[model samples]
Target: MALKGSFERYGAVAVASHWLSAALILALIPLGFLMQDATGETRLIFYRIHVLVGVVAGMLTLFRLLWWAAFDHRPAPLAASRAQHMIARITHVGLYAVLIALVVSGVAMTAKSNLGAGLVSGDVALISPSPIRVPPRLAHGVAARLLLALLVLHLAGALYHHWMKRDETLSRMLPRTR
Candidate 1:
């Protein structure tokens, strides 16, 4: 199969990226909630894992975007209605936008961290050590929350396509049946 997409099914790259990202996000959401209560070394460990997953997702997001731009794929349209087309483009764009925002905000929030939260381990720091910069943290949190909302809508839309429209929305990403 082509890397971008085939006539009906998703390419290996898109399917791989989608499934990988789904798993990462699943882990991240829980870690995010758990980190609030965790303390000391345990929190740091969770932070490390969360950031690792975030970094991986961020990189994959970027690569997938570039791949789409360079080699766009039209994963077998569902209904081809004007609404569907608009949603496809809008939601897809929103997905990319939110992913980018989440990564940036995560990094920003990390920087404003007051405690010894060292998720990023490099000689050079992205935000550097400082007081708990409330503004960046708040901004990051807000953006992340917005991303979650968008994600829900996206999921609902996908379901609508599969159940109501009986389209290839999910199947496009799944391994080919025939």
Candidate 2:
């Protein structure tokens, strides 16, 4: 498969990056919730995994945005009207923005907790002195919930295009031959 996208469909790089980021975000959300009610060693483990995945997703998202800007060609609008096109663009942009916010807030939360060094040093003892609430941490939680809602909308839109409208919209992002 081609590594770069064409006007008609996403290429291999785009598809792989998209799915990777999506999977990481999906995993991180559940981890976040689980960590909240967790304690001791389990909580420490969850915290480490959450931050590590967040960092990976952050880097991947930055690369995806840069790659898309440089290599992706816009396909013809599948929307029937300018309004629909605008809506589609806005939703996509919103999703990207939320994801970036989530990453930033997560890092800020980590910094506020002073866990970076301990997390790296393999000292679960230093994982937390206590759970203190930080503004960025609160924002991160809010962003996570918001991402879930947006993801549902995204999936629904794709399903609408495929099952309801019966167009190439869904396939455009799929791995397929030209």
Candidate 3:
């Protein structure tokens, strides 16, 4: 597959970034939930790993955005009603915005609390008695829910295009095998 997107479909870079971001988001959702209830050593370990993965995901997301802005062009939209096209555009933008918000809020929460220092020094005491009612923490939770909703909408749109409209909407993002 070409490294740069063509007029018809996404190239290898876009395809890879999309899937990688999806995987990271999937991992993060579960990890975020798991770490919340965990305790003792397990909690510490989960927090460390979650932060590490979140950072990677954030960097990858930024890279993807920059790549698209500076080097890649998206394929032309498939034929669809104005409403469908508008919804698709809105969902796409929402996904990017939510992902960015999640990353920023998460980082802010960590930095503003003991989480960041705990991760650095492996000092359990530093992490105990977590901060309460912080703005960033609240924003992070809200962003997570928004991300989930957007993801479901995005998936539904892809399925609708592939199954009902029978267009290249889904396949355009898939990596070519030959």
Instruction: Give the TM-score (vs. native) of candidate 1.
Output: 0.82
Cα deviation at 9, candidate 3, in Å, is 0.6
Question: Against the true structure, what is every candidate's RMSD?
Answer: 4.1, 2.0, 1.2
Residue 126 Cα positional deviation in candidate 3, in Å, after optimal superposition:
2.2
lDDT to native, each model: 0.72, 0.81, 0.88
The Cα error of candidate 3 at residue 84, in Å, is: 1.0
Q: Kindly report which residue stretches of model 3 are placed more than 4 angstroms away from their true locations once superposed.
A: none
lDDT of 2 by residue, 38-127 (tens): 776787888889988988998999998898788675566675667767767778888899989998988887788656766677676666
- Cα displacement (Å) at residue 19, model 1: 1.3
Worst 10 residues of 2 by lDDT: 123-132
Best by lDDT: 3
lDDT winner between 1 and 3, please give it. Answer: 3
C-alpha-based local distance difference test score of model 2: 0.81
What candidate 2 gets wrong by more than 4 Å, as runs, is 121-130
Counted clashes in each candidate structure: 0, 0, 0
The better-scoring model by lDDT among 1 and 2 is 2
Top model by TM-score, which number?
3
Residue 71's lDDT within candidate 2 is 69
TM-score of each: 0.82, 0.90, 0.95
